[model samples]
Target: MDFKYVTQEERERLYNEVWDEPLKIVAQRYNMSDNGLRKHCKRLWIPLPSVGYWAKIKAGKKVFKPDLPKVRGELKRYVHSYAIKYRSDIDKYSDVELQSMKGLSLLTDGTIRYVNEICSNIEVKNQLRNPHNLIKQHKDELMYRKRRDKELQQASFNTDYYNITKSKYRENKPMIPIYVSEVNLNRAYRIINALLFAIEEMEGFANVMLDSGNDKGYFVIMKTTFYFIMMEEGKNKSKNNAEEHVPILVLSLSAGDEYYKCTNYSFKFKDKVDEPLEKQIGIIILEMLQTANKILIEEMLRDREYEREIKKKERQRRLEQMRKGELEEIKILQQAASDWNKAEEIRKFTNQMELKIGEIEDEEKRHKLSRWVLWAKDKADWIDPLIEKEDKLLGESEYIFEEIIETQ
Candidate 1:
């Protein structure tokens, strides 16, 4: 195993992630022993979280981050070696290793560039004034919920939200709702449309479609179906009359058909509505591509490691079978004790073939060698089979009594 190199940005991300959780939890993610990882951190001058940092946060108290130290010389990015743990059933999977993150990053970069080009050339419609009507409906539902805090009303709101806003890519192809004021929705729409176009230009991603209903849509990446969605929460009103609607745009990468979560993310933002449409959408696309890249990389790494383990197990199985064959040969030779030379020749040939089979790396070659080994085994088994004659010879024993009388 080789150490993975991390860039400055990745280092920062890892540092933040470690601080957000316990050391043991973070160590497990990188396949590192906890104490070993702690020592690595010390050697690298990477600061660990304070003893009670997580405790304070859990208790709803304010906590601050420790400043990263300045690098004195050439920076090191070497990570601890990652090992794939053995599992009895690992050989069942078709793919052994997942795609490499390096390759994925290249794809992501291409997608981002494509999206950038699309965004640059395309006209982003002013959709705020004619904003999706579902925005108003969501607001109405919110108002209804505020007046009557019942579960039924909440469920209705949730249903409306999903139906009108989220299921644009389903088989039924439902009607899309006009949600959010045109001002709030246009930026999201423009960015999403650009993303679709960029996905079209990129390889390994296809079946890209935007839904007619709402802002929910779906696409395929690396053979997996993923939903890209934009949802708006109703406006919030403060006593001072400050009003704003929070619109969330996300790509859900999950396992279930009905329930998916936006777990793999590159960037998260706050108060993005105030940003320029191009900047906002560009940033979103960048992060989205990054997230997709990471997912592909993880899948590839898993597949690679899995395949490696499967090969290892196969090698072990072959060796065990060979050992069993050798033991059986030994038993047969001991029984036909008088025909040692003939049996030895057969055993020697079998051993030679077995060694040749082990040395062959090409699978087809190994298979051929294995067939030859089987042939040798069959020849060895036919060495001596006159069990009745051998028994008669033992029973005859005529000279034994005469030798005893002469000795007397």
Candidate 2:
């Protein structure tokens, strides 16, 4: 299904095919559309059956078949594949026939060199030498758990075990997960040690933390942490329905990291059929570093964008603050203008009162009225913001937001 390799499907073969069965059936076999196949037959000089040819043949009537015509140039033969073929002579083919020719290519030299550079000097040895301290710790923990399991099993057989509480068989906690069959554990440890070494070479740390389910491997670099998982093909049901572990160890390595918001990029390396897991360590390292390089580049781009967004938002925040202060200042100016107008009105009223008080015949009453008018003028001055005359009860500080209450 991948490439439908229908090779040498030329004029004579195509002619026989269209005549033998429906174009749709032939198209399905060749992984092509019926209409596209019909056009293909036309260009290949292969004559097709008329619309009612099948019906006539079903009725036991004789049908006419045309002879295949000869094509001059590159239309003589056809093939279906990833690439197209043309004859050695290019000048014989016209523009229309030449259009069918296509070229295919492989990985560029630069990409090959990049992957090779990352994978350089990386390999899994026959045996691990002085395994990393963390690996030793995890190995010891596993041994302790195995012994505890055996103890728990023996205790289960004893009648007195029921008298004891469940806390007696508490399992030792695991560290730095290394999941594999006992047969493949040593190999897995060697591979992991190489992995840890690679991380150290990268000037990054190898860390383990429970992430999402049983996955515990993590690689920290450039202030970013990504999940990593190296697992052997376990006892799994095969296509034949037999459940058994693969005799040859096949390690599958996968890794992923968050990009923007909820987006994640996951990279996986498949096991090579002809080679063992130990032989492919360099290629695995290549894949890992290549994926990391791409992710780090993306992180750099996103960081720049993030910085731009922060600056944009900060500018917006400052503008909002400035607008708020401007509104408060405008309100203060408007309120001051209103109070000044009211103060001028009050002063004019007191002046008129003073003139009226002069007309009184009683000197004592006149003096008392004049004193009242002077007090009224002083009240107006206290109310005016520009004058800011302080009242004995209010002190020097402005209390514009509070109302004065007269105490009895």
Candidate 3:
């Protein structure tokens, strides 16, 4: 496949040409995938237009370009090359190569079947749980403030066990306070236990622990942790079992840098409150497990990518050093070749003048020609040794790289 080495400035120009165009279309022009172009742009610290930028321009609204940040490392030549994948290539691929390109088997049929069986066995116990007066008061205050101030009016409810107060966090974000009822706490534990078993079955082990906050739980995997908080809806099924109640479970994930973002899910108890809570909890836990697995894989891929970049830079540095070592020899040979060509031309001209000396009739002209011939002969004689030295040096050029390698 052919490739073109693009300079940083040239890359920037190409990016600008497609700044307002869709990345997929631009990638097609460059014979690469959209994702490949995006990654290249990211690696080069090139700023790309954000979503809605072109839309804003079409709407006649003012739009601004994002400034590219100055990177602190030496820019390497980007070899732009790619080929669109075709079905024929897959057919032509060797079994080993095709196998290497395939994704890992994340879940087994047995694991899926087991998870489903466990979920089927979950029995939800009916309990008449009421919210504390403080919880009610907080909700009321939140509603009032939300209506009056046009700002988020979340009420604070911190206690010995559960908390619903605005807590300090890494990334500043608005969050709704969870309301965990006495009944839901019991249900939450059952859900947690089931998830632990499922994760253990799938991944061999689980490291889930209750957080210091008392109301939250955390599942740690290597350097990353997934934190979650569950809350109960105050409404309960009537004595006649005519009304249905759904409990809210807030799963707050610990995004690195101490940031926690919550994903909320509500489990409806339909008429199956007597049915074990396994199924409801199983579905949620399965999602969490899938998400956690994805996060872990992404982190691993990122670490490998970083290592590759470091190695690439190191290789470039070594190559640059080798080139610098040979640069002087290369310059000397170039200069020598130039002098040799000039010397040959001068010698030829002097020989032709020698012939002209016999033909000259005027004494003044012959005298001037003789002086010029003497000067040319002297210049050619002086350049002969230098030309020989350059020829020898060119022959020795092959060994220069070997010596550099040995020294390194």
Candidate 4:
């Protein structure tokens, strides 16, 4: 019935008995105030199931949260892909044509999917058609030449030697009338094709110039570079009848002025190059200049991309290292926390033992000396000072008890 003097075991049994009751009922049964009951529950490390716990049980699943919506419409999707596919044709088309194509449904996602499907079909078709046959057909002439060369090698030694030496000399010869190798001729053809393509692409007024021999003859050389030559003839008059003369010949050269050095190739109108030809020349020169410029730009862009990739990798590595350091720091802090908790527990237990010692009555203390003896038996190093003080006090009390006994 005395709450203040209740033993630990009795308090534990009382707590277990009333734990399932309402707070008021439990407090009344224990003859304690509500606040005191609450304090006791807290000290015993008990948790009450609140509304939040009931809500979780009712829900039966985790709650869902949605992320914020993203902003759209910065760029036109798939425009780059379309541009790359039709770059050559697009470059030749007028602005009006480009606009017309831009308005088409190709920009839609459905159209893109259809286009991809078509491309895949085309690839499969080409694969099935054995497209390598077309390549072999194109190289047939080169193969024939190689076969002929091999046959010539198998012929008489003197004939073969003479042919090989003659071929070598022909290869080295400048402006030789002999038939040139097909490979060199092919290269020249490709160059001429490129020049013609440029001229046509520029609408015929290529900014190129040509030299003329006389008013009657215009000649252009296409040896090392392209040139255009023009010539006009003087009027021939009979019986006082005059007529304006037309240019006798208009010639273009894929080769330039570097080839012609003969005085016989004298020109009359070296400065009379067409304005269109001048423009073409300007374009060619501009394109040549831009070649180096393009290369420099591409190299710089590539270097920047590579540097960005390296920086990204380095950042990732640094982040991983930082995470590892943070984990290590957390582990160290957790260990320190555990060690502090254990030291606190030990201090609490020591204080409890000290309180128990203080609570003993004098006669009870003498009778319970055996209990203290047992508690301090193997822990002499820890309780030696306290035990010595207790023994001194007890000895004086015993002498007083003996004096009272004698007086009685």
List, in order, the clash count of every candidate structure.
25, 0, 8, 18
Candidate ranking under lDDT, highest first, comes to: 2, 3, 1, 4
How accurate locally, in lDDT, is each candidate?
Answer: 0.50, 0.62, 0.51, 0.37
lDDT of 1: 0.50
> Against the true structure, whose lDDT is highest?
2
Model 4, residue 239: displacement in angstroms?
Answer: 33
| Candidate 4 lDDT, 1-408, residue by residue in tens | 444333333444545554445566777987889778777554443334343544565678553322211111221120112211212233354434433452212223443353334323321121222223222332453355456666566653787675764465221111111122443333323322343333222212223211241111111111112233321122223333456432221123222123232111121221122432222333342332223223333333455667889999999999998889778666655654554455455556655666666667786774575466545442432223222223433331112233334434
Model 4 segments beyond 4 Å from truth?
A: 1-289, 355-408
What TM-score fits each model? 0.38, 0.54, 0.35, 0.25
Winner by TM-score between candidate 4 and candidate 3: 3
lDDT of 4: 0.37
Model 2 local distance difference test score: 0.62
Leading candidate by TM-score: 2
Q: 2 or 3: which has the higher TM-score?
A: 2
lDDT of 3 at 316: 97
Model 1: how far is 160 from its true place, Å? 25
lDDT per residue (tens digit) for residues 1-408 in model 3: 122455434655766856768788888988999888888777666677888878897899998877655323333333221110112234354434443442222334444465556555554334313422323333454455445433223332325212323232122222223456655555554444555444433322233232452334344432235554433444445546667555544433443432222333223331244543344555555555455444544544555667889999999999998888679556655765776677788899889989979798999999998998997686575665342222332342223334345545
Residue 37 in candidate 2, Cα distance off native in Å: 82
Alpha-carbon deviation at 135 in model 4, angstroms: 29
